[model samples]
Target: MHASDTVDEQLELAADLPPWEKLASKARALKVMEEANKIIEDFPTWEYWVFFLLFMTEFFLAVYVSINLLK
Candidate 1:
């Protein structure tokens, strides 16, 4: 079938590709995670507090609306 020829070509192309190690190794993964943690830890404390307060406000607002609807 014509469809099978396309599939075979795709499979052959995939088989010919070289191994990519960018995110495939444990050491590379750990390095990426460390970099991410460093960025998050460097983020401003004030911003975290502001986000937390905003989230709590939204949560309580949702609860209030739900209770009012049930009344």
Candidate 2:
């Protein structure tokens, strides 16, 4: 009801945590990564590769033209 009461509740909750909470959180995160890998393996796409190749080609052409102009 008061500011001190709210602070006491928060402190109590924090103190009641199990010692292995951090380890358990990391395990849950690893499980999520494993699931993501499975999904990506099942449905791989290649539009990203096409865009990447186009970007690199344009970048190299620009660099080549600039170097030839300086020489």
Per-residue lDDT over 1-71 for candidate 2, one digit per residue giving the tens place of the 0 to 100 score = 22223333444544556757544544555566667678878774698788889999999999999999999
Q: After superposition, how far is residue 4 of candidate 2 from its true place, in Å?
A: 53
Q: Supply every candidate's count of residue pairs whose N, Cα or C atoms clash at under 3 angstroms.
A: 0, 0
**Model 1: which ten-residue window has the lowest total lDDT?**
1-10
lDDT of 1 by residue, 1-71 (tens): 12223433444444545455322343444555667778889988998899999999999999999999999
Using all chains and alpha carbons, the TM-scores for the candidates as numbered come to: 0.39, 0.42
C-alpha lDDT values of all predictions? 0.62, 0.64
* Candidate 2 TM-score, true structure as reference: 0.42
Name the candidate that leads on TM-score. 2
Tell how far residue 40 is off in model 2, in angstroms: 0.8
Clashing pairs in 1: none
After superposition, candidate 1 runs with Cα above 4 Å error: 1-44
